[model samples]
Target chain A: MKSKGALQRAIAENAAGYFFLAPWLLGFLALTLYPMIMSLYYSLTQYDMLTEPVWIGMGNYIKMFTGDATYLKSLQVTFAYVFLAVPLKLGFALVVAGIMNQKLKLIGLYRTVYYIPTLLGGSVAIAMLWKRIFSSDGIVNAILRAVFHVNPPAWIASPKYALYTLVILTVWQFGSSMIIFLAGLKQVPDEYYEAASVDGAGKVRQFFSITVPCLTPVILFNLVMQLISAFQAFTQAFIISGGKGGPLDSTMFYTLYLYTKGFYYFEMGYASAMAWVLLAIIAVFTAVIFKTSDSWVTYGSGD
Target chain B: MSTLAKRRLYAALSHAIIIAFGVVMLYPILWLIISSLKPGTVIFSNPGLIPESVSLEHYVKGWAGVGRIHFSVFFINTFIVCAAVVAANIVSCSMAAYAFARLQFAMKALWFGVMMLSIMLPTHVTTIPRYVMFHSLGWVDSYLPLTIPKLLATDAFFVFLLVQFMRGIPKDLDESATLDGCGRVSIFFRVILPLSGPALVTTALFSFLWTWDDFFNQLLYLNTPAKYTIALGLRMFMDASGNSSWGPMLAMSVLSMTPCFLLFFSLQKYFVQGIATTGLKG
Candidate 1:
């Protein structure tokens, strides 16, 4: 069919391509794919790293649902966080983005100020600061005492308020989502606003009718991303709660619990099961969003 | 009032609201800096925005560090790991990206799809098995676990990002280079890598920042006090001091944030562009 020279050339190109891809291929096989399959297998077995894995089919999953109160607590906490934090963060992001989208002279400076917390939000330093600021005698309480002359509870120490503090911390780092919203806002054409204005639309009415519809796709994206990340939030909880998920297990994020099971408790099988469940949860949430998106998400007319 | 006067009033109102929000947003960070400078005994007692007096005592004591391991060591260790990750991600990811972007290879579409999927797949799924594999190899309690996987292009985000950037480069240049007797590898090095500067910088910046901020892997892999990275060291400092030494802890926290602040301020454009493109496209 083809000339020998052309065939040789094709072979060389294939070889080169594979050569370049070798690193990722090796990593995928060794690191991702192999580990994934092994994790799934491990979830069905009870193996501490010290001994042989004893297979008991679906035992770990059953134990998680029925036997483990901590597991249920973690699930409850993570779901609550995902539901609470994601909406609050996205709402703040959208509102801040709307404000920043105005033709203000100091917008850049404001954006930088808003985004700095997010830029450093994941680090241990910020987490440490969060712990201090929410403590009984910390700056937050001090400010409350000074201004409002009221005795505020130790937000991070109290079992009731600890998780809420983490939620507040999550909301504080909404700047990345805000930045994304700003970019999406820039893509929204000005002609729509002009046309709406010509039709005697008030600001509030235009925002709900035109702006919200146009930004639905961005909203969906932020919501899903934030939901996934919020479900796995660990560092803040780890540092704030001293890696115990305590003040009565109120702030035990799913990933934090999984980490403890894997590393601290050495219940590798249990942790693996948790990981798989997390995957399923994320998958279901993403699927639900995508399925529901047809009701609300609108691509530009050009699409 | 004239329409122009009304416009001025609206602008003033907008500025006031934005500034108020900005102050609230930045108050904590400002407090950290001010607390770091305040006398150790008065940090919690004096919650005023303005410090009554300033001292650099915390900086001096914190830099001396706990248990004879200087804070400088943690900084150096973090920098080393971050540099290795940045270098590794740039080389391995760009090579893979080049293959995906330019080369017509077998099962390229399948591999690219797998790569994209990996980007969304959480690290927790792979972490346990990777730890086991690393442990079996006796690579646990070392930088190998953190840095070696990076060399294998395990971070699919960088590869995907580079692929997106490289696809925008016109293909005629690659063809021209091929005509000029440049081999594929040579073409990659000379033509593609050079032109993909912004993407490479983006990769490097993100790789460095992520590696620097990474607590989990560093916490898992580095066991010794001598090998502690900044994140681990900061945790250790908090544990060691408890609530007794707020001044030094605040000082070290400020120091820990300095490099990130510097990078963000200097290369803010790239950071903004990186976030926008990745979020919008994904």
Candidate 2:
């Protein structure tokens, strides 16, 4: 009888909680959960909005791995972008954050200027401006002539350097990471720095031994977030390559390719399969990072 | 040199480096603004700060966009969508967060965990099914596909952020309010929402900015020229044809940057606070 009364209380408490959570619960069921399950089912079928789906298990995956050259190339392009862009962005952010940490005059002006790109970075206008700036007769070439009296290749047009242009664009907007790193720097207890100074450690030495260790968790968080976003980046590539992944498919991000398959080509099953593969790839990378983080990430002992 | 002189020299060196890069960072935006004001002929030829003559031709033409659809229509559409999204996120997310942070419930941990998982899941994974569903619902070719999910509290990040803030609020207020014969919902209104002003403001700001900057989903859902947002309008100017309008295009791009610049400059403190709060003490 006592156990039965406790169960009744549990039900009553949960009913109130669920009432408050109604909107999210209804949304998750209808929007997120249903779509996820349907997408998985679609991945196993041969359907293109025009006809009824025919069950063709593993056919889409097999075609992607063995027959689709563009699939492999998109994977290569995404991985290269993730590896190169993540490090460049993080390193640039850390360096700038380090500089801003120093007590300097007119720091506000410096920060505002530095952070302007990240604010307006994702807009279509900025993407258009990037295309113009890297074109054959653009300002980059103009600057090259003025500074070094040398000629350079048109960046966006050349397949070899097209991805690098995107990478540089990614680094240009490091203000988000820069802000995060600056926050992390502020949280590094000043007492530790003072103690290190008394032990005869120089500024650089103290940064490496004390500051860097304390920042490992922030670094990990930034890394995982940047990696995930980079894999899904579509706007820059779409605008730069004109959504065709052109100039030899050099800038074909995975998501851009997936969109092309689903919407443009109307190959819904193929696109669904590609989407699942991309999800699994990202999940593995994220899982690996989390698994290995315990060795490197320092979140204060005795938790 | 003495140690004092050496330290002074170091300080000067640091300022020089910082200020120099600051110029480098601002150069592209400055070029964009100047190029927008220049005559079309000299825009590419003369890369000077001051144009030979100033003209608002680009702005005039850009404002009169492709066919009969002016840029003003697009701006109004974007504002409507963003306003709806911001309102939905603030209200729905706060309600869900309040329940999670305060009330005990059956399967509470399970629900919270699933919501968190939604944040890390790439939207592309569900895009196809969602498109098919919306198409079947006859909600395609409209703003419903974009704004409806927000109303449902689909974006879990804000919910997670607000929940963290609510957790940090002292529970004594809740206890006292309850002791004073206030119901659970009353406690939430009288005590919790008041304390959550900063976080809600942050949520509103981010939702507005992200919705404005969003391109892919907007492109997918909204098809007609009459319904295009600013991002789509800019793309119309840059349709990759041989005879692209460079001057007008750059002008519109420059104009597009103004809202974000103004907002960031005006409320940068909260922007920084929002970003900083995300990974603090991990």
Most accurate candidate by DockQ: 1
Compute the lDDT of residue B117 as modeled in candidate 1: 87
Which tens-of-lDDT digit does each residue in B1-282 have in candidate 1? 996997799889889998888888888888888888887655764567798888899999899988789999999999998999999999899999999999988999999999988877878998898898999999988888989998889999889888989999998999999899999999999999999999898889889888888888987888998899999988888878666667777799999999999999998887788777776211
- Candidate topping TM-score: 1
For each candidate, C-alpha RMSD in Å?
1.7, 2.3
Question: Which pairs clash inside model 1?
Answer: none
**Model 2, range A114-171, lDDT digits (tens) per residue?**
8888888877888888898888788888888888999899999999999998998888
Q: Lowest lDDT 10-mer window, candidate 2 chain B?
A: B39-48
Candidate 1's displacement at residue B267, Å, is 0.5
Can you list the residue pairs that collide in candidate 2?
Answer: none
lDDT of 2 at A248: 88
